[model samples]
Target: MRIAFVHRRGGDDEAVLGQAAALGRAGHDVHLVAADADDLRRTPGYATARRTVTVTTGHGGDPVAALRALRPDVVHVHHVSADPGRSWVADWTGPLVATLHDHHPPCASAGLHRDGRYGGSRGARLPLAWASRGGTADDPLLRRADRLIVLSETSRARYTRAGVAPERLALVPHFVPDGTRGAMRPEPVWVYAGRLAQEQGITELLRRWPAGQRLDVFGGGPRERECRAAAPDSVTFRGVVEHAGLVRRLGRYQGLVLPGRFDDGLPLVYSEALAAGLPVLAFDGSPTARTVRAEGTGTVASWDASLPAALRAASLVFPTLRAHCRARYEETYGETQWVTGTERLYAAVVRAGAREFA
Candidate 1:
């Protein structure tokens, strides 16, 4: 099958390209449409076309003509620029579908989580982000997608409110390959991957962690210096680590500390951690945390006054946490989970001839 994946990126966007690359490796003809090449060179099977504008989510030609040129069996979009009104695919006809990786339509910061918290007033939610050039995702383009895929139930709820019909929302997870999972070997190094954004709450995690607890902070962000300063003497800053480095790094950590206050669907970062056999310590007051909270796979708290105690208890329950995290990964997000869920969605979209309601 010929699948064209589209996303406009000015950053390290392996998450978007990883899906197409994995699909290609799994026997599909995958093509990529994007705004940059620095990141693309590293992604296998990635092919690019020229762009007429910087943020238009459309190809240079007419929407129909552009898609027609690709002749794709499926069009899987991961993002649309803030002006989704300018996105060409909005008018195209091939199995229209996308994964709402973040709250881009309703939130300019895209996390619907800003000022380091989740869910706020419309003004706060819609800051700078517009699904259409002039309109928020409250109408039109959001409703246009045949099916809307979200990473977590928390994201599904937000999208549903953002005007994507609940019927159209599919909770399809991001892919995390077995090769990505690490060998959680020795020591109790708590891991924090992804950008060290305060929205990610890594600063709070370090500040609140008990003294003497060793932590490894990976990924760079605007708050890198602050995170470094707030870190306890036990913490180590490894700077920016790639996907493989992440897995190798996870092997040294007993668990991952992913206390994000943002509604970023399910971060493949956390998914990657679980696959690596590292338990998660997370706090998100939304259904999104269900994956990690289900029956002790890891500890999930509300990030309220009660959170610090929960974190302490979780550290003590390391043996149980270790056992369950691996179990949950095997049962729900292992090799089978990655391939089965994605191919199923692709096949269904192709057969139905439209991205059906999930």
Candidate 2:
């Protein structure tokens, strides 16, 4: 099938591009429609695509016009701004599939971390209620899609409660290419590879970090200065590492640390860590923590005195969990599974559209 993926050149565009590459590798003709040429060139999936078409909405270039010209059988949208007026999906009337990488219309904050709590006190119920009442700008656009791809069960439930038909929502988690090249002994050091922010629990991680435990911090964010000041001598700030480079280096660490206190619908890093055969150390109440506990892929701990014990426990079992982590990745979060499932969804949506017209 010919598929055209539309991305708005946002933070999560790499995942979308990676999915396109996965589909391309599966023998489907895939084209990327994006706004930035530099990103298209530097990103991992660009080189593998059949073709790429750049769209400049500010310069009078219509994305719908460009997509219509391509005449793809399916149009898959990855990430677009929440504004219906600015979104090109509003004008497209074809077999369309949209992936919601974050909680936007239902949470408003998108990250679901509000007032220093994950999903606030009421979780997504309040925002979902607001969305159900047509309180969000993107509600209409979200409803218009032939299918809405959610990355986690939490997201699927939130959208469903927001009045999206159950049939329209598909739970397809993100996938990452395997980063392990053979097997290498891991060091006793832990790694954190995302934004250094309060909501991510970086501040709490630094404050409550066990003494003598080595942690390498990657990426930069709003709390960099605060985190740096509060960080113990055992924690090293490695600055921002490119995604490819980070994935390559993941296996060297004992485990990936996700201290975030939010229910971040299946972060891409989770897949990357699993791909590298690296276990994760996630905080309690987060989605990653739930997966870690359920899958035996890593350690789940609270942001308290018990965290040190959890760290020690993870160290003791790290060797055994490494293979299990990789196995879980292959079974659930690998490119092949994701691509096949997505293809099925694409075919279903296309068949549904055909039946509607028939």
Please report the candidate that would top TM-score against the real structure. Answer: 2
Please provide, for model 2 over 8-116, each residue's C-alpha lDDT reduced to its tens digit, 9 standing for 90 to 100: 6666656776788778778887777765645557766666552543232322223677777777788888755444423566677778898887654444466343212
Q: lDDT for every model? A: 0.62, 0.75
Backbone clash count for every predicted candidate, in the order shown = 1, 0
Candidate 1 residue runs with Cα over 4 Å from true position? 10-12, 35-39, 42-63, 84-87, 111-140, 180-184, 284-288, 301-312, 354-358
RMSD in angstroms between candidate 2 and the native structure over all alpha carbons: 4.8
Worst window of 10 by summed lDDT in candidate 2 = 53-62
Model 1, poorest ten-residue lDDT window?
48-57
Estimate the TM-score for candidate 2: 0.86
